[model samples]
Target: GAGLGDHIDRKEGQEHTFQNADPARRQLNQSFAVTDHCSKPLHTAISDRIAEGYTGTTAIRKDAVRALSLVFTGTHEDMKAIEADPEKLQGWLKANYQFVTQEFGKENVVRLALHLDEKTPHLHAVVVPLVEGKLTAKKLLGNRKDMSERQDRYAKAMEPFGLSRGVRGSKAVHNSEGWYLGQQQQAQKAVLSDLPKLTALDRINPARYEEKVQERFKFVSREKTDTAIELKRRTDQVRHAQASQHKAEQEAARHREATQSIAAQLLQAGKAGITLDSSYALLKAPAAIREAANTLFQEEVRKLADTHLKQGAEAYYRGIYQLEDSSKATREDYERHQKHDSEETRNHIAGEITRIFNQEIQQRWGVELSPEASLYKELRKKAADLVRELAKTILQELRKALGLEEPRQQRKSRGLGR
Candidate 1:
């Protein structure tokens, strides 16, 4: 039973009174009403309306039933599943809405609020008890038998949603919500009562618990320092790898461009009417062109390998040196912050490590590797093959123009193979 004083300061939309509330989760709270529940509390908003429409002239009893308050919710896991599915949440809300409306009439079912500002999803509903134009909570829900029947009916109504009735005929006595909470607190105290209770003398004794605190803090600080060092080490390794990859890409690009240039030179020589054995040849045009193409391509590859490999090695070692410098800075930072011996420092270090690993390292490694290097190598191979084929075709055509035949030894070998 609530005292008259209870209603003095109570108001609607004040959900902070509920246990297990988290202010951070207030954004997830939801409220709905068939009437004006936001501007007034549930009792006055719902019960007063039902009384106004009552057919009987008899005054409403002081102890008469007002709003029938109900809490509808499930365990954390079940609530999470329901929250994930809007259809499931809608179905659950609709089921409860139907039950309340059918039992108390649509006009009497006033307020339905869903609270997500707690550990689990739940709803608080107010149903004004108006039966056959009379306000009587006892007739509707006074006895245990009636209550159990109501539970059974609600359970059956919600069967489509996979809900079942709690254990029937259980011997647990119903108590007020405040009483239940008080009992829970007592039980918690009893569990913790086994620990040694400290006296006033023990509170001021520095020798008792101070050493344990300092030891724990020292252990946590050391762990954080080690973690910071490890993270710096891995970051350096990744930078070194990236530097080497950059060098490889530059080498591939340079070689590809040089190959295209050489092909262009060959095309220009052909356009100039320089025959294989023409005067343009250092000795003879045929041998001279062959030497130029092979030697130039070989020299390009040799130069590319030397330049890129040397630079990549140097960059890798320089990254290692930079890593050492960064590690020293991190160590100094840790020492500066560790003197405070606060939990915040440990948490910050942990969060930083997680951020670096998840964001930086993950993005770097998960990125799609560039195909330019492989494509360049492939193009180089194709270019070499094209040059060989073209050279072979030109040699055969020239021999024909010169009225030459296959050498006698080569012709005999072909005949033998056939």
Candidate 2:
């Protein structure tokens, strides 16, 4: 996409002096006259205009006329398809030109110039936004209605060409949504309402209260440990599946090697003039026994070749069977692993709830004397410890499942306890 100012140097009677404006902001103007008589020569006219310096104009003007040149760049994939048949591409452009003109405005839109001299083929569409004395950027952008409505219309317009709406970034959508102040107010209110309630006695007898809190903390830790264990189990199942597939592939390769070895042995025996036993030989063999034996030997050689050919087909079928079996086994193992992991995770989560109850609820109430408070605090601590241990175990299992090398253990001291 390119844009620049046009008519930088005003004609003798014009009021505006476009050349006096900043050169950085101006568009240099040039025009070309073409005859409609020859359809085949349209490309030649466009090439001449590009060479004469109309597309990349840089002249500045104080009150310059607004102009834009749009060039559709075909990707490598599109170029490949178009190169297969150039006429198909030409027809496509001719059909889509009307839509282009409608978007830029019928009067504002100029003739398209096709340039075929460059390494990449592209169409140059020159547009002058100003029709009469008025110029509209919104009109040129095809923003005739509200943005949402325009998007819907654009989707409909491009549907026939197998083109869908372009994807806008997630940030753009977020910014658009955040424009409304009411959403901000609702978000603030929701956050405040979710905060936990505090107790009055939390300020007094804090030491006694802390004892009960610690006990509950242990219980919550234990539950999280269980969850980590479950995740590890799932990872192990995936590894098992992969191992099974590898074994099947190895077996297949061995079978192929065995088949080829047998064929080679048979071919060697045939060349050595080895005779088959009488039971194996056909009748009318003794009269031309030497020639008949040779023919029989050649038939055996052909049989060996056929067996070698069958090995390839057999390997393919075996591979396919292994793939299907491995896929099914892997899926089953994963499902089982997930089930165990979820159970462990649930236990860990339960432990967390106990910790939260002790720390945030029971401890605040200063209920250390109560048997329930002490039990809860102990449970929370246990749960937290268990969760930490399970996490380490899960990490080890994940490495093993992913075929990563296990870490070496450090040597322990041989001395007895002091």
Candidate 3:
């Protein structure tokens, strides 16, 4: 970005400096040399070097590069370490200056400066492309192989200072921030566009509409599996990201298992080849169905949540404490996980609830409950709400399902009788 300038009227205490550092930081920048010969300004010195190097010929082209600019620094941490120690910093500067002077012959290095006020301390050098007493930029610039060997030489020189070559910029990154969200929306809209047109009848019947949507659009998108899974579990992104890798993987695995199990339930129902004309509401159903649901829920679902899921949540935190060292961040994370129903546990609970409801419908009434059915929606809502209530209001030791505390005190304060 530096332009060609043969003259510059520099302010006081800022001569022979090429760095465009902040005016406030100019005091922190050090100019080591500008031509081993005369004490001239930076631009004047640069022009003089190019003129002196040209041996033969016609006027020089205006666009010709007079010198190559080189910048060298190690990793940020390494540079900071050298800066902290005066001995090491001086040695590093010496090593770099020697490398530049040796590489371009002491006479051709027009200007050298060390910048220390920036986040990374680095050396900048300007070298005239003078070879065999003639201006030959190509000879000094060299082919790829020659340039690589030149890099190796510099690395060898800085070896004692623990400086090494930065990683090569060969990979082209294609995506920017929010690229995932854009891609997800595009994929979702593309997939959902292909559904068959709903009839007036279908519009009236949400069950038929929902079943058609489910049957036609099985995947969020088929182009990428990871993206598909991510879109399917979109609500879980923030929780998944802050959680440990092990916890995140557990959630993904549990999700896949629950989905597969629900698919198998549908398949089993289809294979039986029995169908009922309509559905029954679990609460407002015949006395027989209502009584059966409450009794079956007690036996099949509630017991599982009270024992296995609760203990599993507690055991999970216990294992977390054993494996992970104590830290303010980790402890905070553990406490948050305890407070919420973890996605993995949530998925398992939903799957079990769905399984029991499906079994109840198919076995007792020969009906397969579509998600749009009033009975299916009500039962699922009631079951999930029950779990939430227990976790929040907390009944007796059932408070432990959510890692709740102060049950007796809480109860008395809330006016629950003894």
Candidate 4:
């Protein structure tokens, strides 16, 4: 049968012992009591010597019998933690056992005992050849190549638990390059042996292979190349557009800041009780002071408008009660006052003019003084004539700035004249 063999002991009733086994020759050793099927009473002192000797010896005798031993050792602390919660430990062991069984055939594997006599926790697995045979020490215990691969596998398996390979002096196992090469050779042998056979035509089909190669080349050169170029172009376009928009936004923001600063200065001037005429003169002052004066002037105009409206409302209400004969005259007088007598009304109208001036400042770096201002009263009297002259000057400047086109009729007339 290929399954586990029936229990058999070579020593019989005599206690099985290996007190003289060399310690250096043993790859792995730890004390464990036999419990699953076999029972043996071995003295602690003799058992310890056997384990130590097995680890230290190297010589192998001809005709020596081969056997497998599996030892399960448990620490008092781990046993307690596991006993308190057996499901956790049991789950871990079950998964580990499955993995081991897959790696090493289950039939050749054996669990010798589960010992709870130690302070540290561990499991011992002893694997033997399926049939009774002389097991070389190199085979029973792993060689350098086998040990290295075993170590790599162990590290990979324990990675999920956050265990890593340690230094030479550390307890963690290390893998060597030689072990890796051996594993690669073993894998290659297995693969070569298991691969199915194929006919020459089935493996190489020349016409079909040529078609596939051409198709791949066309795909890379045409579709992939075009897509890459388009991607680069789109990326550059997007970056350029973003930069342009950012520049425009920054310029707009700066314009807004400048306008606000001017308004503030005007407000400060109004608060200081400076006459609008005097403030107008300050417009030609240094940039910082000019902005302050403009803000104050604008504020003064708004305040003047509010005052006029309030006063007009009061006068209108009072005039309605006057005698009928005097009422008409009083109403006419009130109307004139509302139209021009109120300083507040003049200031309110001036504020609107100042807003227009600010717009002009943005467009042409120039501000127009309101005709209603005390300093420009004479100009306000001939407003229509003054406006005509100013408009002509503005048109001339605009023509110069824009390089205005000549009228079609004028061009034709000039041609006829010529």
TM-score of 1: 0.39
Q: 398 in model 3: Cα distance from truth in Å? A: 99
When 1 and 4 are scored with lDDT, the better candidate is 1
lDDT of 3 by residue, 76-164 (tens): 68899998899999898898888888878888876677777655677767777788866778887788778778878888888888876
Instruction: Give the range where candidate 3 is weakest over 10 consecutive residues by summed lDDT.
Output: 1-10
Error of 2 at 252 (Å): 36
Collision count for each candidate, in order: 2, 39, 0, 28
- Report the lDDT tens digits of candidate 1 across residue range 231-297: 6545655666687699999977866765675466578867866443322322333443545644554
Off by over 4 Å in 3: 1-25, 167-418
- Judge candidate 3 against the unseen true structure and give its global Cα lDDT, from 0 to 1: 0.58
Over 1-418, each residue of candidate 2 has an lDDT whose tens digit, in order, gives 1111122122343312222233342232222222321122323433332333234344424354345556543433454455456686655465446655666554454445443333334455555554333443445454434555655565565454444443332122322212322443354345445544447857587666754564344334433443444445456546666776898999778666655754564576588664444322333223334345546644553453245323433233224224223223444443344455554564655454444433433233322223254545555455445444543454445444555554444112333232
lDDT of each residue in 14-85, candidate 4, tens digit only: 221211223353333222222221233222322332333343244545444333444332224544565355
Off by over 4 Å in 2: 1-65, 142-165, 169-418
- TM-scores, each model vs. reference: 0.39, 0.25, 0.37, 0.24
Clashes of 1: 2
Compared with the true structure, all predictions reach lDDT values of 0.54, 0.43, 0.58, 0.43
- Sort by lDDT, top down from the best: 3, 1, 2, 4
